[model samples]
Target: MENNMTNKLPKISEAELEIMKVLWSNSPQTANEIIEELEDTMDWKPKTIRTLINRLVQKEAVSYHQDKGRMYAYFPLVSQENYLQVETKSLLQRFCGAAFKPLLVNFLKEEKLSSEDINELKRILDEKTEENKRKDR
Candidate 1:
């Protein structure tokens, strides 16, 4: 793990994650803009969306800048990759006993992976194996 990712991170709920997704796609947007983007998918009311945004802001996951006419444009402070890493680690610890092979095998058995997917996994494994061999020297 990188040093930047080693520090403690704020926990985001499912609702807050929805808001973060909106910001992540197109950042520095107003609350109304965010609501508009999610209108087709989410049935959440404007107030509910605002509440989620506020929660994220309080958590320091999202920040806002002053836009035109007193409006604030919000953006994410944490990258999606960083959050995924934390989530993956937590999941591994809780469900997979901090081991990756079991989780990966479970996924492989559950999902119908295509040939491309299998090949990609093979490529990644090869790269990892090479790196480990280098370290063993």
Candidate 2:
């Protein structure tokens, strides 16, 4: 199912990630549309972009349907949030021995958080605590 597919997500390179970002912003884009968007920010040629698109397709991260006259519109098969969740778990496993508390502590200690950001974090923690309490009952 969807969970199994996510567990097997292909490893995406940095360059491939840039292509995914564009698709994530707006989907069902033709190759030319993707090229145009990236041309403004990236130094890569259109062919290079096309190659990256092909690679993503091969990786099953992207899927395409023929638009018109041999042209195709591509869309992401994987959601950005799902990909981020997997990547975050992998990162935690690799760096923090899969201990989430240390990672949270490190980030809270090292990174500057706005008052609003801190409040949001507190809200999320409170919600989780409440959910756990209800489950234990």
Question: Which candidate has the top score in lDDT?
Answer: 2
Give a tens-digit lDDT track for model 1, residues 56-113: 9898999999966899889999888888888888888888785789778888999998
How accurate locally, in lDDT, is each candidate? 0.87, 0.93
Give lDDT: candidate 1, residue 113.
88
lDDT of 1 at 93: 86
User: Model 2: which residue pairs collide?
Assistant: none
Cα TM-score of candidate 1: 0.84
**In angstroms, how far off is 47's CA in candidate 2?**
1.2
Model 1 global lDDT (CA atoms, 0 to 1): 0.87
In model 1, what is the error at residue 59, expressed in angstroms? 0.8
lDDT of 2 by residue, 17-125 (tens): 9999999999989999999999879989999999999999999999999966889999999889989988998988898895889888889999999999999999999
